[model samples]
Target: MTVEFAGEYFPIQPGGRFVVGREGDLSIDDNLFLHRHFLEIAESGGLWWLANIGARLQATVTDATGGVQAWLAPGARLPLVFATTSVVFSAGPTTYEFTIHSSEPTFRETRREREVEGDSTIGEVPLTLSQKQLLLALAEPLLRRDGTGMSAIPSSADAAARLGWTVTRFNRKLDNVCDKFDRIGVPGMRGGAGGSATNRRARLVEHVIASRLVAKADLTLLDVGETDPADAE
Candidate 1:
Protein backbone atom coordinates (compact mmCIF):
# COMPACT_ATOMS: atom_id res chain seq x y z
CA MET A 1 0.00 0.00 0.00
CA THR A 2 1.14 3.58 -0.72
CA VAL A 3 0.73 6.59 1.48
CA GLU A 4 1.38 10.04 0.03
CA PHE A 5 2.64 12.56 2.51
CA ALA A 6 3.99 16.00 1.57
CA GLY A 7 4.30 15.26 -2.16
CA GLU A 8 6.16 12.03 -1.48
CA TYR A 9 4.45 8.70 -2.11
CA PHE A 10 5.88 6.06 0.20
CA PRO A 11 5.08 2.42 -0.37
CA ILE A 12 4.19 0.47 2.74
CA GLN A 13 4.92 -3.02 1.55
CA PRO A 14 3.59 -5.21 4.28
CA GLY A 15 5.86 -8.12 5.06
CA GLY A 16 2.62 -10.06 5.53
CA ARG A 17 -1.08 -9.58 4.83
CA PHE A 18 -2.16 -6.01 5.51
CA VAL A 19 -4.43 -5.34 8.48
CA VAL A 20 -6.14 -1.92 8.35
CA GLY A 21 -6.65 -1.73 12.11
CA ARG A 22 -6.75 -3.76 15.28
CA GLU A 23 -10.04 -5.03 16.69
CA GLY A 24 -11.26 -5.89 20.20
CA ASP A 25 -14.37 -5.92 22.41
CA LEU A 26 -15.46 -3.17 24.76
CA SER A 27 -18.37 -1.97 26.94
CA ILE A 28 -21.40 0.17 25.88
CA ASP A 29 -19.93 3.65 26.51
CA ASP A 30 -16.86 3.10 24.35
CA ASN A 31 -18.29 2.73 20.83
CA LEU A 32 -16.50 4.54 17.97
CA PHE A 33 -18.26 6.64 15.32
CA LEU A 34 -16.86 8.24 12.16
CA HIS A 35 -17.63 9.71 8.74
CA ARG A 36 -15.65 10.06 5.53
CA HIS A 37 -15.48 11.64 2.05
CA PHE A 38 -16.51 8.44 0.24
CA LEU A 39 -19.59 6.25 0.50
CA GLU A 40 -19.84 3.95 3.52
CA ILE A 41 -21.39 0.49 3.29
CA ALA A 42 -23.52 -0.63 6.17
CA GLU A 43 -23.38 -4.35 6.90
CA SER A 44 -25.44 -6.35 4.44
CA GLY A 45 -26.23 -10.01 3.84
CA GLY A 46 -26.01 -10.95 7.53
CA LEU A 47 -22.63 -9.30 8.14
CA TRP A 48 -21.48 -7.94 11.51
CA TRP A 49 -18.54 -5.70 10.63
CA LEU A 50 -17.60 -2.59 8.56
CA ALA A 51 -14.74 -0.07 8.01
CA ASN A 52 -13.25 2.14 5.27
CA ILE A 53 -10.00 3.61 3.92
CA GLY A 54 -8.90 7.24 4.38
CA ALA A 55 -12.32 7.74 5.94
CA ARG A 56 -13.38 10.25 8.61
CA LEU A 57 -15.54 8.57 11.24
CA GLN A 58 -17.33 9.71 14.45
CA ALA A 59 -18.61 7.34 17.15
CA THR A 60 -21.27 7.76 19.81
CA VAL A 61 -24.17 6.09 21.71
CA THR A 62 -27.88 6.66 22.41
CA ASP A 63 -30.90 5.52 24.48
CA ALA A 64 -33.89 3.37 23.51
CA THR A 65 -35.61 6.28 21.78
CA GLY A 66 -32.47 6.86 19.64
CA GLY A 67 -31.85 10.25 21.18
CA VAL A 68 -28.22 10.76 22.20
CA GLN A 69 -24.92 12.26 21.02
CA ALA A 70 -21.20 11.61 21.49
CA TRP A 71 -18.56 12.47 18.87
CA LEU A 72 -15.54 10.27 18.20
CA ALA A 73 -12.29 11.43 16.66
CA PRO A 74 -11.28 10.55 13.11
CA GLY A 75 -8.93 7.61 12.35
CA ALA A 76 -9.00 6.14 15.84
CA ARG A 77 -9.93 2.48 16.39
CA LEU A 78 -12.49 2.28 19.17
CA PRO A 79 -13.53 -0.89 20.89
CA LEU A 80 -17.13 -2.05 20.53
CA VAL A 81 -17.70 -1.45 24.22
CA PHE A 82 -21.40 -1.27 24.86
CA ALA A 83 -24.61 -3.27 25.58
CA THR A 84 -26.92 -2.08 22.80
CA THR A 85 -27.28 -5.22 20.69
CA SER A 86 -28.47 -3.11 17.72
CA VAL A 87 -26.16 -0.56 16.04
CA VAL A 88 -26.77 1.54 12.96
CA PHE A 89 -24.16 2.82 10.44
CA SER A 90 -24.89 5.58 7.96
CA ALA A 91 -22.91 5.79 4.71
CA GLY A 92 -23.32 8.76 2.43
CA PRO A 93 -21.38 11.58 0.82
CA THR A 94 -18.93 13.63 2.92
CA THR A 95 -21.42 16.46 2.73
CA TYR A 96 -23.94 14.60 4.88
CA GLU A 97 -23.06 12.69 8.06
CA PHE A 98 -25.09 10.78 10.67
CA THR A 99 -24.52 8.60 13.74
CA ILE A 100 -25.81 5.58 15.68
CA HIS A 101 -25.58 4.67 19.35
CA SER A 102 -25.96 1.19 20.84
CA SER A 103 -24.85 -1.27 23.50
CA GLU A 104 -22.62 -3.13 21.02
CA PRO A 105 -20.44 -1.62 18.28
CA THR A 106 -18.69 -4.19 16.18
CA PHE A 107 -18.77 -3.96 12.38
CA ARG A 108 -16.77 -5.69 9.67
CA GLU A 109 -15.85 -4.28 6.28
CA THR A 110 -16.16 -6.84 3.51
CA ARG A 111 -14.14 -7.18 0.27
CA ARG A 112 -15.20 -5.13 -2.70
CA GLU A 113 -12.23 -5.15 -5.11
CA ARG A 114 -9.20 -7.27 -6.10
CA GLU A 115 -5.59 -6.99 -7.32
CA VAL A 116 -3.89 -8.71 -10.25
CA GLU A 117 -0.14 -8.76 -10.61
CA GLY A 118 1.62 -7.97 -13.86
CA ASP A 119 3.07 -11.13 -15.56
CA SER A 120 -0.08 -13.20 -15.88
CA THR A 121 -1.48 -14.74 -19.08
CA ILE A 122 -3.71 -11.72 -19.55
CA GLY A 123 -0.60 -9.53 -19.42
CA GLU A 124 -0.47 -9.54 -23.22
CA VAL A 125 -3.67 -7.63 -23.74
CA PRO A 126 -3.70 -3.83 -23.87
CA LEU A 127 -5.35 -1.80 -21.14
CA THR A 128 -5.47 1.96 -20.73
CA LEU A 129 -3.73 3.28 -17.63
CA SER A 130 -7.04 4.43 -16.15
CA GLN A 131 -8.63 1.09 -16.92
CA LYS A 132 -5.89 -0.79 -15.17
CA GLN A 133 -6.06 1.51 -12.15
CA LEU A 134 -9.81 1.13 -11.81
CA LEU A 135 -9.62 -2.62 -12.26
CA LEU A 136 -7.08 -3.11 -9.49
CA ALA A 137 -8.85 -0.67 -7.21
CA LEU A 138 -12.16 -2.48 -7.58
CA ALA A 139 -10.78 -6.02 -7.42
CA GLU A 140 -8.52 -5.51 -4.40
CA PRO A 141 -11.32 -4.36 -2.10
CA LEU A 142 -13.45 -7.37 -3.04
CA LEU A 143 -10.67 -9.87 -2.48
CA ARG A 144 -8.75 -8.29 0.38
CA ARG A 145 -11.62 -6.59 2.18
CA ASP A 146 -14.70 -8.69 1.46
CA GLY A 147 -12.81 -12.03 1.21
CA THR A 148 -14.84 -13.21 -1.79
CA GLY A 149 -13.50 -15.15 -4.78
CA MET A 150 -13.52 -14.02 -8.42
CA SER A 151 -16.63 -16.04 -9.24
CA ALA A 152 -18.66 -14.75 -6.33
CA ILE A 153 -21.00 -12.04 -7.58
CA PRO A 154 -20.82 -9.12 -5.14
CA SER A 155 -23.48 -6.48 -4.73
CA SER A 156 -23.15 -3.31 -6.80
CA ALA A 157 -23.48 -1.22 -3.65
CA ASP A 158 -20.21 -2.63 -2.39
CA ALA A 159 -18.46 -1.95 -5.67
CA ALA A 160 -19.87 1.54 -5.93
CA ALA A 161 -18.65 2.52 -2.50
CA ARG A 162 -15.11 1.40 -3.17
CA LEU A 163 -14.88 2.93 -6.64
CA GLY A 164 -16.37 6.22 -5.47
CA TRP A 165 -19.26 6.01 -7.90
CA THR A 166 -22.99 5.93 -7.80
CA VAL A 167 -24.54 2.46 -8.08
CA THR A 168 -25.43 3.18 -11.70
CA ARG A 169 -21.94 4.44 -12.49
CA PHE A 170 -20.32 1.44 -10.83
CA ASN A 171 -22.42 -0.94 -12.95
CA ARG A 172 -21.20 0.79 -16.07
CA LYS A 173 -17.55 0.54 -15.00
CA LEU A 174 -18.06 -3.15 -14.17
CA ASP A 175 -19.35 -3.78 -17.66
CA ASN A 176 -16.22 -2.19 -19.06
CA VAL A 177 -14.05 -4.47 -16.93
CA CYS A 178 -15.87 -7.51 -18.23
CA ASP A 179 -15.47 -6.33 -21.79
CA LYS A 180 -11.77 -5.83 -21.33
CA PHE A 181 -11.38 -9.38 -19.97
CA ASP A 182 -13.30 -10.77 -22.93
CA ARG A 183 -11.13 -8.91 -25.42
CA ILE A 184 -8.04 -10.34 -23.74
CA GLY A 185 -9.38 -13.93 -23.61
CA VAL A 186 -8.61 -14.22 -19.90
CA PRO A 187 -11.26 -16.64 -18.62
CA GLY A 188 -11.50 -16.20 -14.85
CA MET A 189 -10.30 -12.66 -15.26
CA ARG A 190 -13.68 -12.46 -16.92
CA GLY A 191 -15.18 -13.87 -13.72
CA GLY A 192 -15.35 -17.64 -13.71
CA ALA A 193 -13.93 -20.25 -11.30
CA GLY A 194 -11.16 -18.02 -9.97
CA GLY A 195 -8.19 -19.53 -8.15
CA SER A 196 -4.42 -19.66 -8.45
CA ALA A 197 -4.53 -21.17 -11.94
CA THR A 198 -6.80 -18.57 -13.45
CA ASN A 199 -5.36 -15.68 -11.50
CA ARG A 200 -1.81 -16.64 -12.40
CA ARG A 201 -2.64 -17.01 -16.07
CA ALA A 202 -4.45 -13.72 -16.32
CA ARG A 203 -1.84 -11.88 -14.31
CA LEU A 204 0.94 -13.32 -16.43
CA VAL A 205 -0.61 -12.02 -19.61
CA GLU A 206 -1.51 -8.68 -18.07
CA HIS A 207 2.01 -8.15 -16.79
CA VAL A 208 3.61 -8.91 -20.14
CA ILE A 209 1.30 -6.56 -22.00
CA ALA A 210 1.67 -3.72 -19.51
CA SER A 211 5.46 -3.93 -19.71
CA ARG A 212 5.38 -3.70 -23.53
CA LEU A 213 6.88 -6.96 -24.75
CA VAL A 214 6.33 -5.40 -28.24
CA ALA A 215 6.26 -8.68 -30.20
CA LYS A 216 3.16 -10.47 -28.92
CA ALA A 217 3.91 -13.75 -30.75
CA ASP A 218 7.58 -13.82 -29.72
CA LEU A 219 6.98 -13.50 -25.97
CA THR A 220 7.92 -16.64 -24.04
CA LEU A 221 9.30 -17.51 -20.61
CA LEU A 222 12.79 -18.91 -20.16
CA ASP A 223 12.66 -22.69 -20.29
CA VAL A 224 13.21 -24.24 -16.86
CA GLY A 225 13.44 -27.69 -18.53
CA GLU A 226 12.00 -29.48 -15.51
CA THR A 227 9.27 -32.09 -15.20
CA ASP A 228 5.91 -30.93 -13.89
CA PRO A 229 5.91 -31.12 -10.08
CA ALA A 230 2.64 -33.07 -10.05
CA ASP A 231 4.23 -35.72 -12.32
CA ALA A 232 7.72 -35.79 -10.67
CA GLU A 233 6.88 -39.10 -9.01
Candidate 2:
Protein backbone atom coordinates (compact mmCIF):
# COMPACT_ATOMS: atom_id res chain seq x y z
CA MET A 1 0.00 0.00 0.00
CA THR A 2 1.09 3.59 -0.60
CA VAL A 3 0.16 6.92 0.96
CA GLU A 4 0.53 10.08 -1.09
CA PHE A 5 0.33 13.73 -0.02
CA ALA A 6 1.83 17.10 -0.93
CA GLY A 7 3.87 15.64 -3.82
CA GLU A 8 5.38 13.01 -1.51
CA TYR A 9 4.71 9.30 -1.43
CA PHE A 10 5.16 6.63 1.23
CA PRO A 11 4.97 2.96 0.41
CA ILE A 12 3.89 0.55 3.09
CA GLN A 13 5.53 -2.84 3.28
CA PRO A 14 3.30 -5.86 3.79
CA GLY A 15 2.47 -6.26 7.48
CA GLY A 16 4.29 -3.01 8.11
CA ARG A 17 2.96 0.04 9.97
CA PHE A 18 3.22 3.70 9.00
CA VAL A 19 2.68 6.67 11.32
CA VAL A 20 1.65 10.03 9.95
CA GLY A 21 2.00 13.41 11.61
CA ARG A 22 4.49 16.22 12.17
CA GLU A 23 6.91 13.93 14.04
CA GLY A 24 5.57 10.52 13.13
CA ASP A 25 7.45 7.71 11.39
CA LEU A 26 6.16 9.24 8.16
CA SER A 27 6.58 12.89 9.13
CA ILE A 28 4.51 15.56 7.40
CA ASP A 29 6.46 18.64 8.43
CA ASP A 30 4.44 21.28 6.66
CA ASN A 31 1.29 20.95 8.78
CA LEU A 32 2.05 22.78 12.01
CA PHE A 33 -1.13 21.85 13.87
CA LEU A 34 -0.77 18.08 13.58
CA HIS A 35 0.01 16.06 16.68
CA ARG A 36 3.39 14.33 16.92
CA HIS A 37 1.76 11.07 15.90
CA PHE A 38 -1.71 11.72 14.58
CA LEU A 39 -2.67 8.67 12.56
CA GLU A 40 -1.51 5.13 11.82
CA ILE A 41 -1.90 3.02 8.71
CA ALA A 42 -1.17 -0.63 9.11
CA GLU A 43 -1.36 -3.68 6.90
CA SER A 44 -2.83 -6.56 8.87
CA GLY A 45 -4.13 -9.89 7.64
CA GLY A 46 -4.07 -8.71 4.03
CA LEU A 47 -6.25 -5.72 4.85
CA TRP A 48 -5.29 -2.08 5.39
CA TRP A 49 -6.67 0.09 8.19
CA LEU A 50 -6.43 3.73 9.18
CA ALA A 51 -6.61 4.81 12.78
CA ASN A 52 -6.62 8.18 14.45
CA ILE A 53 -4.11 7.93 17.26
CA GLY A 54 -5.54 10.27 19.89
CA ALA A 55 -5.12 13.43 17.85
CA ARG A 56 -7.45 16.36 18.49
CA LEU A 57 -7.68 16.90 14.74
CA GLN A 58 -10.64 15.57 12.72
CA ALA A 59 -10.54 13.51 9.53
CA THR A 60 -13.04 12.57 6.83
CA VAL A 61 -12.80 9.18 5.16
CA THR A 62 -14.59 8.40 1.91
CA ASP A 63 -15.04 4.91 0.53
CA ALA A 64 -14.62 3.94 -3.13
CA THR A 65 -18.34 4.44 -3.72
CA GLY A 66 -17.69 8.18 -3.27
CA GLY A 67 -19.79 8.17 -0.11
CA VAL A 68 -18.51 9.38 3.22
CA GLN A 69 -18.03 6.49 5.57
CA ALA A 70 -17.01 8.20 8.76
CA TRP A 71 -15.69 11.31 10.44
CA LEU A 72 -12.79 10.08 12.51
CA ALA A 73 -12.64 11.87 15.78
CA PRO A 74 -9.76 11.47 18.18
CA GLY A 75 -8.88 7.82 18.79
CA ALA A 76 -11.18 6.59 16.02
CA ARG A 77 -10.23 3.94 13.47
CA LEU A 78 -11.84 2.75 10.25
CA PRO A 79 -11.05 0.35 7.47
CA LEU A 80 -9.93 1.70 4.11
CA VAL A 81 -12.45 -0.14 1.94
CA PHE A 82 -11.32 0.87 -1.47
CA ALA A 83 -8.45 0.54 -3.95
CA THR A 84 -8.00 4.28 -3.49
CA THR A 85 -9.38 6.10 -0.47
CA SER A 86 -9.23 9.85 0.00
CA VAL A 87 -8.77 11.53 3.36
CA VAL A 88 -9.42 15.22 3.78
CA PHE A 89 -8.48 17.11 6.89
CA SER A 90 -7.13 20.41 8.17
CA ALA A 91 -4.42 21.38 10.59
CA GLY A 92 -5.02 24.93 11.74
CA PRO A 93 -5.35 27.17 8.69
CA THR A 94 -3.81 24.73 6.25
CA THR A 95 -5.87 21.99 4.63
CA TYR A 96 -4.32 18.63 3.76
CA GLU A 97 -5.31 15.95 1.28
CA PHE A 98 -3.92 12.43 1.33
CA THR A 99 -4.74 9.25 -0.55
CA ILE A 100 -4.19 5.62 0.34
CA HIS A 101 -3.76 3.08 -2.42
CA SER A 102 -3.78 -0.69 -2.34
CA SER A 103 -3.98 -3.44 -4.94
CA GLU A 104 -5.51 -6.01 -2.58
CA PRO A 105 -8.95 -7.16 -3.69
CA THR A 106 -10.08 -7.40 -0.08
CA PHE A 107 -10.04 -3.64 0.15
CA ARG A 108 -12.84 -3.36 -2.43
CA GLU A 109 -15.52 -4.64 -0.07
CA THR A 110 -17.24 -2.28 2.33
CA ARG A 111 -17.43 -3.92 5.70
CA ARG A 112 -18.78 -1.11 7.86
CA GLU A 113 -22.04 0.80 7.54
CA ARG A 114 -21.61 4.49 6.77
CA GLU A 115 -21.74 6.69 9.88
CA VAL A 116 -22.52 10.00 8.18
CA GLU A 117 -26.28 9.61 8.61
CA GLY A 118 -26.25 12.60 10.96
CA ASP A 119 -24.96 14.89 8.21
CA SER A 120 -28.46 15.84 7.21
CA THR A 121 -29.01 17.22 10.69
CA ILE A 122 -26.14 19.65 10.23
CA GLY A 123 -28.22 21.78 7.90
CA GLU A 124 -30.99 22.10 10.40
CA VAL A 125 -29.23 24.92 12.24
CA PRO A 126 -30.79 28.00 10.80
CA LEU A 127 -28.33 30.86 10.24
CA THR A 128 -29.27 34.42 9.55
CA LEU A 129 -27.56 36.38 6.80
CA SER A 130 -25.73 38.46 9.37
CA GLN A 131 -24.42 35.33 11.05
CA LYS A 132 -23.15 34.01 7.74
CA GLN A 133 -21.52 37.36 6.95
CA LEU A 134 -19.65 37.23 10.22
CA LEU A 135 -18.53 33.69 9.51
CA LEU A 136 -17.27 34.73 6.10
CA ALA A 137 -15.44 37.68 7.63
CA LEU A 138 -13.74 35.45 10.18
CA ALA A 139 -12.81 32.92 7.51
CA GLU A 140 -11.51 35.42 4.94
CA PRO A 141 -8.04 35.58 6.41
CA LEU A 142 -7.39 31.86 6.08
CA LEU A 143 -9.08 31.32 2.71
CA ARG A 144 -7.50 34.27 0.90
CA ARG A 145 -3.91 35.53 0.98
CA ASP A 146 -2.74 39.10 0.90
CA GLY A 147 -0.41 40.59 -1.70
CA THR A 148 2.31 41.45 0.83
CA GLY A 149 2.50 37.79 1.89
CA MET A 150 1.43 38.45 5.48
CA SER A 151 -1.27 36.64 7.40
CA ALA A 152 -4.64 38.26 6.93
CA ILE A 153 -6.21 37.05 10.15
CA PRO A 154 -7.84 40.05 11.69
CA SER A 155 -8.35 40.98 15.31
CA SER A 156 -11.92 40.79 16.52
CA ALA A 157 -12.13 44.56 16.49
CA ASP A 158 -10.82 44.70 12.94
CA ALA A 159 -13.27 42.11 11.73
CA ALA A 160 -16.08 43.93 13.46
CA ALA A 161 -15.05 47.13 11.80
CA ARG A 162 -15.07 45.44 8.41
CA LEU A 163 -18.67 44.44 8.94
CA GLY A 164 -19.68 47.85 10.29
CA TRP A 165 -20.33 46.38 13.70
CA THR A 166 -19.16 47.25 17.16
CA VAL A 167 -16.80 44.89 18.96
CA THR A 168 -19.42 44.08 21.58
CA ARG A 169 -22.02 43.18 18.98
CA PHE A 170 -19.48 41.18 17.00
CA ASN A 171 -18.45 39.12 19.99
CA ARG A 172 -22.05 38.47 21.02
CA LYS A 173 -22.93 37.27 17.54
CA LEU A 174 -19.85 35.11 17.40
CA ASP A 175 -20.85 33.44 20.65
CA ASN A 176 -24.25 32.70 19.19
CA VAL A 177 -22.64 31.23 16.07
CA CYS A 178 -20.39 29.03 18.15
CA ASP A 179 -23.39 27.89 20.12
CA LYS A 180 -25.05 26.82 16.89
CA PHE A 181 -22.07 24.74 15.86
CA ASP A 182 -21.88 23.21 19.32
CA ARG A 183 -25.53 22.18 19.16
CA ILE A 184 -24.76 20.28 15.94
CA GLY A 185 -21.56 18.50 17.16
CA VAL A 186 -18.97 20.28 15.03
CA PRO A 187 -15.64 19.97 16.80
CA GLY A 188 -13.45 22.96 17.60
CA MET A 189 -16.30 25.42 17.13
CA ARG A 190 -16.99 25.96 20.80
CA GLY A 191 -14.74 28.02 23.02
CA GLY A 192 -13.22 26.19 25.96
CA ALA A 193 -9.98 26.04 27.91
CA GLY A 194 -8.52 23.76 25.25
CA GLY A 195 -7.36 26.67 23.02
CA SER A 196 -7.23 30.38 22.53
CA ALA A 197 -9.76 32.49 20.61
CA THR A 198 -7.54 32.57 17.53
CA ASN A 199 -7.23 28.80 17.55
CA ARG A 200 -11.00 28.48 17.75
CA ARG A 201 -11.38 30.82 14.80
CA ALA A 202 -8.99 28.75 12.73
CA ARG A 203 -10.77 25.53 13.63
CA LEU A 204 -14.14 27.07 12.83
CA VAL A 205 -12.85 28.07 9.41
CA GLU A 206 -11.45 24.59 8.89
CA HIS A 207 -14.76 22.98 9.73
CA VAL A 208 -16.77 25.37 7.59
CA ILE A 209 -14.51 24.76 4.60
CA ALA A 210 -14.33 21.02 5.14
CA SER A 211 -18.10 20.66 5.52
CA ARG A 212 -18.87 22.96 2.57
CA LEU A 213 -20.96 25.14 4.86
CA VAL A 214 -19.17 28.03 3.26
CA ALA A 215 -17.42 28.53 -0.08
CA LYS A 216 -15.41 31.10 -2.00
CA ALA A 217 -18.42 32.03 -4.11
CA ASP A 218 -20.35 32.82 -0.96
CA LEU A 219 -18.12 35.80 -0.41
CA THR A 220 -20.33 37.65 -2.83
CA LEU A 221 -22.95 37.93 -0.11
CA LEU A 222 -20.60 40.19 1.83
CA ASP A 223 -20.35 42.63 -1.01
CA VAL A 224 -22.46 45.73 -1.24
CA GLY A 225 -22.85 47.67 -4.46
CA GLU A 226 -19.61 49.50 -5.36
CA THR A 227 -17.44 47.16 -3.29
CA ASP A 228 -13.76 47.28 -4.05
CA PRO A 229 -11.94 44.06 -5.05
CA ALA A 230 -8.81 45.44 -3.41
CA ASP A 231 -10.49 45.22 -0.02
CA ALA A 232 -10.36 41.45 -0.20
CA GLU A 233 -6.62 41.59 -0.76
The prediction achieving the highest lDDT against the true structure is 2
Instruction: Estimate, for each residue in 57-95, the C-alpha lDDT of model 1 and write its tens digit.
Output: 432322222322233334533332223321222222111
| Error in Å for residue 86 of model 1 | 44
Residue 17 error, candidate 2, Å: 4.2
Residues 1-233, model 2: lDDT tens digits: 88887567888888889998888767766556778888899866656789998558878776545434468888888876678776767676555657788777454454875667454644366767777778888777655542111135577898889888889888888888888887877677767675468777766765665555666678887765324442322
| lDDT at position 27, candidate 2 | 76
Instruction: Pick the TM-score winner.
Output: 2
Residue pairs of candidate 2 with colliding backbone atoms: none
Compared with the true structure, all predictions reach lDDT values of 0.34, 0.71
For model 1 the local lDDT of residue 47 reads: 34
Off by over 4 Å in 1: 1-123, 141-154, 188-233
Summed backbone clashes in each candidate are 52, 0
Give the distance in Å from residue 33's predicted Cα in candidate 2 to where it truly belongs: 7.1
lDDT of 2 at 228: 45
TM-score of each: 0.25, 0.59
Worst 10 residues of 2 by lDDT: 142-151
